[model samples]
Target: MGQNLANHLVPSQDYDLICENLAQTKEGADILRLKGGIPLANLETVTPQLKRLKIGAVLNGKELAAIGKILRSTSEIRRFFKEITTPEVPLPTLNQLLIRLESLPELTKVLNLSLEDDGYVRDEASPLLRSLRRQISGTEDEIRQRLVSFTKGSQAKYLTNAVVTMRDDRYVIPVKTEYKKHFGGMVHDQSASGATVFVEPKAIVELNNRLRQQQAKEHEEILRVLRELSQEVAPYTEEIDQNMRILGQLDFVNAKARYAADLKATQPELSAENDIYLRQVWHPLLDAKKAVKNDLAIGKDYKAIVITGPNTGGKTITLKTLGLIQLMGQSGLFIPAGEHSRIGVFTEIFADIGDEQSIEQSLSTFSSHMVNIVEILKHVDDKSLVLFDELGAGTDPQEGAALAISILDAVGAKGSYVVATTHYPELKAYGFERPETINASMEFDVETLQPTYRLLLGIPGRSNALEISLRLGLDTMVVEAARQLTSQSSQDLNEMIADLVEKRHTAEEEAISLNKYLTEAEKLHNDLRKAYNNFVSQRDSLLNQAKAKANEIVENTRKQTADVISDLHKMQQSAGNGVKENELIDAKTRLNKLEQPIHLQKNKVLQRAKAKKIFKEGDEVLVKSYGQRGTLMKKAGNHVWEVQIGILKMKLDEADLEKIAEEKPQKTVNRASVKRSRSVRTSASLDLRGKRYEEAMNEVDRYIDEAIMAGFPSVTIIHGKGTGALRKGITEYLQSNRVVKHFEYAPPNAGGNGATIVSFK
Candidate 1:
């Protein structure tokens, strides 16, 4: 099926649509590769049954089963497409083919219930059929039982064998001819030996007759079921037929996709300007690993290319590669070419390839070729791609070269795209002289005496006849004699071509080296960009945290100050004349404690200083200037150490270095131990809304210590705004505490003033 579809060629006017289908095919192949594979192996074409159904013809069980299998495949394929399609890469073309497809589960269910896997109607297809079969089975069982009883009874002596058998669908027993009258039953059949005659006893004959009648009824029931099923299918004949066609088209597309993947081929782009460009294109039929790839382009810069080279140097292969690739593209199959290859749609493609000599017509090779060329000349126009191999070869060199040149000119005059291969040096010169024409060659390795099969555009191939002879150990005298006999103009032309080949080789090497460097540079640029973005993101996060902490501390301090002043005024009003000494002393003590937080705030640098610890080389330490951890390289000077952070190296004061310990795997803990230390693992917030003032203060103290140990940046204390007593108390405590860097209310959405958020130093 795949081969048949691949061999088909669509019309030129449908080239765009064909290309679209090829693109869709390639996409489907890629998805199938990722999604395990397509589940279309069991999908059989039911076109025949579908046609029968279209004409309202009754189909048998097998035919219906075939159509059922196709419906099952349709559902599977549709589900596959739906599952794999994504917004990022939707299969627009493939999904379009499924627009009319539906999951008619009821119809599918009915068919599946009625038929077996091989298309035979099941006994349970209908209640009447089931009942009829059951009756037929029971009657056969009764007949067999009656015959068995006879074999065991006194009448068994008349039987030649005690086995019961059937003759023409009725049960009977074999009896000796002499005892046949004793059996007293109808003779159904006689054995090969006349001594035995098969007959049914009178007693079971009635049972056999009843069984036969039941079987006949069973047959009628099966036929009636099949006819009903066919009628059920008739209503949907047009839809089912359309579905079969769509399924076949999808299968064809999938096959092409699979073949393309095997070839590692790419779909060709439609050239808007009749231009052809194929890079690293190889003959599709040739082994890709062994076949040398080449670039072939024409129609854009030049209307024609004249490839001249020695025989068996891949010149003919080049012509075929171009023509075959173009044809494959037109047929909606991917070509064996590199990505970005473009192909022009041609109204006609003419080829005069290989030997076409005719013994019957007595025509020479040249004449035969002329006949093909004449036909091409008459039909070719600006939209045709013409390929000729060994053009103008089977004749005198002088006449052949001139004739090849004239033919090329004639084709070019028509503006038709042409590619031809020849071995004539005159044609090489003619290529350079002609307008809209270029000369190309198949590369040859002179030392190895083998063709490299590399096509070199803008250069003519050299005939290394003398070089080959010398390499084969031909006498130097012969080679020198031949070289001396060569014309000076020919000698000059060969030398010029050799020099050009050498220059092109050097230039290609340089281009390859430059491309390698460019790739590395681009990769480095991307790495640097990513690293810069990460650095900026980390820096912003840390700065925001620090700013929030500072603002909270300032706001809490102001609130605490206002509360203390209010308390002092109330105390004075209650005392009237004077406050007690103890009470006055208590107030002074509270005021003195407040000074500690102020001192810490003033000496922030001292508060942030790390404990003294000896540092050594290879130890990880935090670089204060960069706020990043780095490996300690060495001591640069007294109280100075050099650190390596990422790719940067820096020397900083020892005071800036804070040694960081390497983390080790922790030992497994017991659940009981975790519960015992629950207070040590404090949460980010505490609730003090219902607690007494004294108890709440104590809880706040313990929670703050736990939060600090847990490395919490800030914690919320939920003290209801009611009575303003708890809020005022917590704020005053936070303000006087040296470790409390900040305290403030959370946002309105998060408990607002009822919650006090605290940050530790």
Candidate 2:
């Protein structure tokens, strides 16, 4: 089925849709951990049987069994897909197909109970069939006993061989031809040589007749059973046929997916424009272990690529790879290319690949190629992909090069994308001379005298004939002589190409080094940012704790003072003249002085220090040690100042601080203000319980971003175990998230399957 699907091309209008569906099916298979469903090996086409039933033809037991097997498999498949195709892990395209599959419980159950695996009707199928078989068994046993007795009797000598067998559904014994009349009641058969005759003994003739009658009755009962099963299937002929068709379609889709997985292929991004970009793509037919990968792109900035190089340098392979992958993409199959590879849908694909010489037609290689090129030019358009291998070859070099240029010109003018491979150096010049064409080549190693098979785009190929000869033990004098005979213009072009290749190699190496350094710098920046956030969090936590403790102490002192005053008033009331009101007021004034909050005195001291240019809280000071400005928090100890700078907190000696500016007025802390401050603080866990899938994902994304920014090593997402939609969605999201290093279900005590612990990179 996969081969059949691959052999044909899908229409361009439906191509992208088909590819998208196939990609979704592959994703569904991955999520389910089953390729498509149960092994389709047991699935057999039952369309013919269904057709027979539709025409009122009775289906045998085997045909019915085949149909039953399909029905059962369809049910299993429907159930399997339903297990994972929830709101969280939605597979819309595949789900549409699943929706059409109807389970036939009654029909399947009846077929399974009535027929055996090998298509024979079971005795349990009906009581009458069982009784008939039993009677037949009993008569057959009696007939065999009587025959054995005859074999052991006095007339046993007449038997040619003392064995009983059946001829024409009747029990018979082999007898010597001369004694046939002595032993037989009836001659059933005679041997080929006329030496023996098979005789039915007259002694058990009536028993044999009874056994035959019983056997006929059994046959009638079996047919009746088969007919009943067929009638049961007749009503479901349309449904059964539909089920088979759906299963075939699903199997075909799954086969493409399995092929993609096995090949480690990725879904290519289809584009509206006729631009191609294949990254690290190799020929699918080649041994991936040994095949060299190359990147090629065209049809965007340039409409054609003229690949010029010596024979066996993989120029042909490059052409074939591009052409084949294009077709594969259009056929709705994932291509054997790296991720992010982009392909365009072409209305037509023309290839003049390989040798096309014809003997019967008396056409030369050049004529054969010309015939193909002429045909290609007729229909080539902007949406067409044209490939010409060894174009204009087997002819004069100058004329062939000119013809190749003209053909490329014609094709490019038509706005068609063309890739042509040739050995003509003139075409290399043509690639440079033309505006919409680029030069490309396969790398050759002069030292190894072998092609590296690495494609270098934007650089023309060098023959390196002299260099190769020198490396292969040719004398230096002869090599130098050969090089001297070459035209200086040709030598200059090769030299320029060599220089460009070498420079490109050097640039690539430097780019790799720069990228490495850039990555290291980014890592360092992230580490510093995380450290700052952590410090800020701890600082704020400690500050809040200290403020709460201070507030508690002030409250306790206030309560004590109130209680003391009440005691004093009660004593005055009791003592009357013993304690005067004036004295009581004076004592209360002293107590009031002591009852003042500590912060009030500290504020007075701060005011007095400010008059003398002394640093205090609310003063912005620059720390000499870090050369960064910070707000003065408080005095930590003698001559030590605690300061807050961005996310960092530190204690520095007064001598290290320089007053930079005065701080602004502090705002009164309120409930809303505290809540706003706490909102930015990252926590070790987030609760998403009872949230919808989209809502949960939004929270997850925001939470993870904050977690990474705050430098949390890992955070738990509490989605809770309900329908598992949220959990599955979160897991999949994390898998594709660039920042998330890994994620897994939390431990049993920590929400178990209900939560995921996500660790960031």
Cα lDDT of all candidates, in order?
0.78, 0.78
TM match of model 1 to true structure: 0.66
Determine the C-alpha RMSD for candidate 2 after optimal superposition of all C-alphas.
21.2
lDDT tens digits by residue: candidate 1, 677-715: 222223678998888999999888767654553456788
In candidate 2 the C-alpha lDDT for residue 469 amounts to 81
The local lDDT score (0 to 100) that residue 653 gets in candidate 1 is: 83
